[model samples]
Target chain A: MRRALKVIVLGVWLLITLFPLYWIIVTSLKPKAEIFTLPIKYWPGNVTFEHYADLFSFADFGAYLLNSLLVSLVAAAGVTVIGVLGGYTLARFSFPGRGALMLAFLVTQMLPLFIALGPLYLLMSDLDLLNRLAGLMLVYVAMLVPFSTIIMRGFYERVPVALEEAAQVDGASRIVAMVRVVIPVMLPGIAATFIFAFVQCWNELFLAITFIDSEDAKTIPVAMNSFITQYDIDWGSMAAATVVSVLPTLVLFAAIRRYIVEGLTAGAVKG
Target chain B: MRPAFTLRKARFIALCLLPGVVFVVLFTYYPMIRGMVIAFQRYNLFDITSTPFVGLENFRAVLAEDRFWTALRNTGTWVAVSLFFQFFLGFGLALLLRRHFRGRGLYQAWVFFPWAMSGFLIGLLWRWMFNGQFGVINDLLLRTGIIDQRIGFLATPGWAMTSVIVANVWYGVTFFAIMIMAALQSVPKELYEAADVDGASKLRQFWHVTLPHIRPTLALIVLLRIIWILNFPDLIYSMTGGGPAGSTDIITTFLIQQVIGGDYGRGGAVGLLILGLLLAFSVFYMNATRFEKAR
Candidate 1:
């Protein structure tokens, strides 16, 4: 009886958790007429891809998708590179003010980015970066670098220092030892940090909406937000766009799920 | 033995750290400081020709508004109610998911998938799902003989808050489940075996063994989630736009409105207030965590 109850409980929670996702996918595939029937169709009666076609044809969704992809990619790569250097320095080297620097990174993680939104807008406007993809990338890199650095630092600490010493003993210079020896071992960590940063940048909406006003520069979230704000929200197309927008993050997340769980645990609880 | 610190080493260290430091200072700190400065000025986005310092005027204006207080009150409800449900339900979930089972990995992945999603998109999904006329929720309720009529979940003020909180609870439970599960795993099997040897019942073992083990993590995560939930306006923004007379408007959403309305001064004021609130909580949280560590 207890075992049966436990299974039922888990099953119910699972349904609650996944129903929205299932509903959206099903709703996206449903024909326009079938979407708003008297009794809501549990499943789509007639599947159609017209909404997906409409997403690209009628709306600026193609541009939004490209912009989201480009910005998230560049920013993720930029933050990961910066995170590698910073994380390595913090991990391997001890210098004056290093403690303060680490503390600063931690404090930045605690801060709400919304507190900086207004001035960030003004600063971007002054730099003529408003409505620009590069500008958005810069903001994302800055926003993401702190957590990425911490995650990388955790990864570095796990690898014994003796490896680097062994490399140096083998006539390898410090830089060469790091590049050839340490980095190879940290590839999984690097990929995890990169994907984590990528997902964050892709999912970002507030800064994207605030900074990117032009249709050409708008990201996926901003485009989807605009879609909903229209007088007559095209539920079919919105659902379709949402599915497309979510796919990259879902795929990337599935790839790095284990690393993310570990990273988050370390970064949040221990850090 | 490691080499002594040298000029070349210092140079290399500086080289390694400079890019990140510069980026952070240029983007995060610079804007944050500028935002604080803007709070004291007459910085309207419409007319930026002259933004002279006006000490505490923006703060004063924001404080005087009835909407700000309403948002503040709503923020309390939003965070508390959401956190309450999220913690308990998530704790239950973590307990249930602790055991090894067939397809556990896939089940975990499927359940935690919502956490990977964008807040805005989640809001949009929930908004449509809660729609009055054609919403699945209402349809399900009606078909199941729960409600006789279609009810606008987002249209009514009380229901609007409930609706948003429900979405938040759904989205956030996974996080607590994941964190708590991680914390649970860290408790050694030996400890549980010892408790079992002591003839502790399942409930008592949970109280004596599990509770103490994960309390520190629980406290920290709860604090973090409070700040995050307060900062999270994306869900509420896309869901109701803090609609039906600002019923669901948290302080962050309130700040977003100030920015969207082209009142940078007021927005900055709101931002400072949020910063102050979080900082205060963070100080207390840090001290509490330190106490936990010491114990």
Candidate 2:
């Protein structure tokens, strides 16, 4: 009986969590008239991809998708590449102000993305980079580096220095030792950092909305805004768009979900 | 092969590290320092540096502005309310999920999904859910006979704040649950078994065993989230556009207005003020946590 009750409770919560997601998928497939039917049909009797087709045909969604892909991909690659090198240095070398430098990096990460909003905007304007994809890439990369570096630094700090030294003593170069030894061992951290950077870039909103205005340059979140104006909501198409938008992230989550969960827990508790 | 991975003598490490340092300095610290100067300069609405400095002028105007106070108050309220619920609900939900169960992985993903969503999207989603006329909430509430009329949740001041809080709590709870659940799972099971053998109740066991074990995790969450909650902007911007009567204005939104209003100096002043408060909170939270640990 207790076991039955536990399952029931879990079932209820799961339904609550999954319904909105389910609602979007079902609503997306349903025709407009059926969407608002009195009983609110939980399933679509007529499943069609009209809304999805409309989403791609009537909208610049393809551009937004490419932009989102480019910005996030660039940010992920940039943050990881930079983070790996800097993180390695911080982890291995004991330079003066090392602790202070690490603390400063944490402080930078702590600062709200908008803390420098005014100046960053002015600087962007001055450089004539107001809506440039390259500019957005620059901001995303800078914003993500500290978090990535911190994670990478922790992973690098853990590798047995003796192993690296032994290899070096055998006449292997430092670069080779790091490449062959430190990096392979740190793959999990590297993977986690990449996902972390990509998610952050993808999820960024305030700056994205504020900076980018052109149809060709818009990302998914910004592109989706036209569906829900203050007056009326295009629920069906909006739901369809939302699902399409969420699909990639869902795929991303499934891929790195394990790394993300473990790293997040370790990051908060250990750091 | 011999010198490809050469030692400390090689300049490769410095070369490798240079690009990242340049990136951070140019994008992060440069803007930070430059923003400080903007707080002083008149910031030629058209020409930037051509404008003359007007020391303390921008600060005075910002302090005198009524909307600035509104933004600050709402920001404080927002930070306090979000931090409170995020901890309680997150902890509560984490405890609920701690027990081993079927489809645990699926449930975990469902709860964790919102945190991964862009704030812009979450803002848009909640806006639909809270729509005054055709919203899912109004439909449900009306069907249940809870109210005769729609609540106008994001329009009225009292409800507007509540609306943002509810949305924030929805997303915030998952963050806490994910973090806390991990730490909770790491806890040894023997302690619970030992407590059961000692005839201790679940509540007592939770208070004495689970609470202490996860205090560090809780403290860390609280410290970090205080800053994050304070900084979050889309929660304000999308929901109400800082709404009905500037009722939901927060510092970040206020800064946006300053930028749009062409008052970069005043906006920069607000920026600096916000940065100061953020720093204070960080130090305060860290010290307090340290004090609690020491005692």
Candidate 3:
């Protein structure tokens, strides 16, 4: 009896947690007329792919997708590469201001992103970078690099220093030694950091909205904002867009959910 | 170690660190300093040529506004109420999930999915659900005879803050659950056994054994989350645009509004105010927890 109750409670909680996502999927499939009907349809009566079809024909969603892909990929990859090098340095070597550097990285994590908003806008505009993908990429790299560095450092701390020393004793240079010894061992950490950075860049809206105004440069999040205005809400198209936009993140997250959790734990509690 | 060798090692390390450091300084620190400078100027977007030092005029003006005070009060409510419910519900859910069960992995994945979702998207989802005319919430409530009329969850000042907080709590619970569950699982099973030997009840065991072990993680996460919650305006922004009557407006969204209005000076002032609050909170938190000394 007790076991049954536990299962039922957890099942109810799961339903509550997933109801919004389920609703979006259901709403996306419903015919347009059923959407705003007084009695909300629990399930779609006439299922159709018309909304998804409309998104492609009428919107520049393709461009937004490409921009999002380009920005997220570049920013994530840049952050990971920089993070790995910096993480290794912090982990392996004792240097001047090392303590301060570590503290600064932590402080960066706590600092509100908007602290740099106005100035960065001015700077980007002055350099003719406003409404540019490259501008967004630069800002994202700065925002994410600190967190990625800390995660990378946590993983590096777990690897024994002896392995790197052994590689060096075999006449390998420091950089080469890290490449041969540390990279393979830290691949999981690297992947985790990449996904974390990628998801962050993908989900970012405030910065993207602020920086990119052109149709060619808009990302998925910013592009979706057009559906929502004071007058009208294109519910069907919006739902379709949401599902499309969140699909990559959901898939990537499910694939490496454990790593994401572990990375967060390390970054949050252990760091 | 020889002096030459130590120097070379330092140089190599510095070389490795240089790119990351330069990026951070140029992008993060540089912009922050610039933002501070902009707080004292009339940096309008359209008429940048006439920009001149304004000497605390922006600060005074922003502070003098009625919306600023409303946003401040709403921010306090948003953070405090959201944190209260998230902590309890999250802790409860974590405890429930801690026990090994069938399909726990699947349950865990779905339960944690909301945290992976973007705040704006979550806001959109909730907005649809809470739509007064055709909302799932009202449909369910009406069907169940809970209410005769639909509540405008996002349309009224009284309910808008609650509505947004509900969404925030849903999105944030998974974070607390994930962290707390990890902390819980790490507590040695032997502590429970000892508590059992002491003739403690299940609740007592939780209070005396589980609570003490997880206190540090709990405290730290709460501190960090307070800062995060304050900075997080995305969900609130999308839902009501801080809505019906500026009822749901928080400082972050208020600052964003100023920028969107082409009032960079005022926006920068609000940003500085937020920065100051966060810095003060961090110092107080660290001292209260003796976080630095513990290290």
Candidate 4:
């Protein structure tokens, strides 16, 4: 009885958890009429790729995808570089205002992005960066770098100082030691930080919508919202667009999920 | 006592730190100060030439509006109900996942996928699911004989808030589950073993051994989750745009609406209110939990 109950509960939770994902994918593949049919079809009768083709062909979906890619890639890379340096310094060094710097990062993490929205818009406009991918990149980097630095700090904290000291004793320069020994050791943590930063940039919506206005510069989320706000939505194509938007993050997530979980636990549990 | 700071070390640290500091100050700190200043001015995005200082007029105007109170109440409901359900269901799910089982890794991945997606996209996905005319949810309920007629989950004011809360709960469950599960794993086995040897029941063992071990994690997660849920408006914004007469409108959405409508002064006023609320909450939470003392 106990064993059966466990199995049943787990199965129910699984169905509930996975159903939305399943439903969206199915909706994307279904014919338009079938999507709105009463007593909705649990499974698509005729699997079709018409919506996917339409998204790529008639819509500005290709530009949106490219824009998302360019913005997220540059922002994620910049955050990782900054995060690694700042994280390492905080983890391994003692300097004037180190405590203040750490507190500042924490404060930034807790701040509501809405607080910055109105002024940031004005600032971006003043700089003539409105509707530009570069402006969005700057905002994303600021939003993500603080959290990434904290995650990177956790990674560096786990590494013992002895390793770096041993390298220095062997006559290696500090920079050379970090590159040869510390970097290799911290590769998994760096990978985890990179994936986390990349996914955040890929998934951000509010700022993207606010900052990017032109059709050519819009990211997937904003473009998807445009489809939503319209009077008549092509449901199938919209669902397909949703799938395309989430696919990259989902792939990156699956590949390094274990590391991501570990990174999170390390950051929080230790505190 | 501190380690001696050498010249080369300071130089290296400065080099590493300069870029990140500059970016943060320009984008984060500068905008924060500017947002505060904008709150005191009669600023309108549509009219850039007349942003003169207006003292407390904007704050008074925002606070006087009935919509502000409605949004405040809705925000409280949204955060409280969502957090309550997310905490319990998430903890339960974590316990279930803790037991080793077949295909558990895949199950974990599937369950946590929602947390990986954008909140706005999640909102859109749930909006489609709760569609008044063609939603899968209504279809399932009808097919199962739960309701004789279709229900407008998002169109009805009473249900709109519930619908968005449901979506928020679903999106947040994985966060609590992941954190609690990690804490659960790190609980030493010896405590359970000792309890069993001492003639304690399973419930007692759990109460004594498990709860205490995860309390800190629980406290921290709860604090962070509250702040996150309060600041989050994307899911609700995309789902209903706080529609059906603003029943689902939260403070964040209200502020966003003001900004979108080109009223910068009112939006900045609400923004400052949110910041003040968050600051107060953080101070209270730190005192209640004694988190700072622990640190």
Show the lowest summed lDDT stretch of 10 residues, model 1 chain B.
B215-224
- Taking the tens digit of each residue's C-alpha lDDT, what string does model 3 give over B229-282? 888888988888989889999999999888877788998899889889888877
State the TM-score of the second chain for every model: 0.95, 0.91, 0.93, 0.95
Candidate 1, A1-271: lDDT as tens digits: 9889999999999999999989999999999999978767888888899999999899978888889999999999999999888899899888899999989888877667777888999899999999999999999999887888888888898999999999999999989998999999999999999988888899899888889879889998888878877888899999999899888878888888788676665444221
DockQ computed for model 1 against the true two-chain complex using alpha carbons: 0.63
Q: A127, model 4: CA deviation in Å?
A: 1.4
DockQ of candidates 1 onward, in order?
0.63, 0.42, 0.59, 0.59
Kindly state the fnat score of candidate 3.
0.63
Better of 2 and 4 by DockQ: 4
Which interface RMSD values do the candidates have, in the order shown? 2.4, 4.0, 2.8, 3.1
Q: What ranges in model 1 sit over 4 Å off?
A: A266-271, B285-295
Best by DockQ: 1
Residue-level lDDT for B20 in candidate 2: 72
Q: Which digits, one per residue and each the tens of the lDDT, describe model 2 over residues A64-109?
A: 8899989999988998999999888877776555687677677676
What residue runs in model 2 are displaced by over 4 Å at the alpha carbon? A1-5, A30-48, A225-233, A262-271, B1-13, B44-50, B186-201
Q: Model 4 segments beyond 4 Å from truth?
A: A262-271, B1-3, B291-295
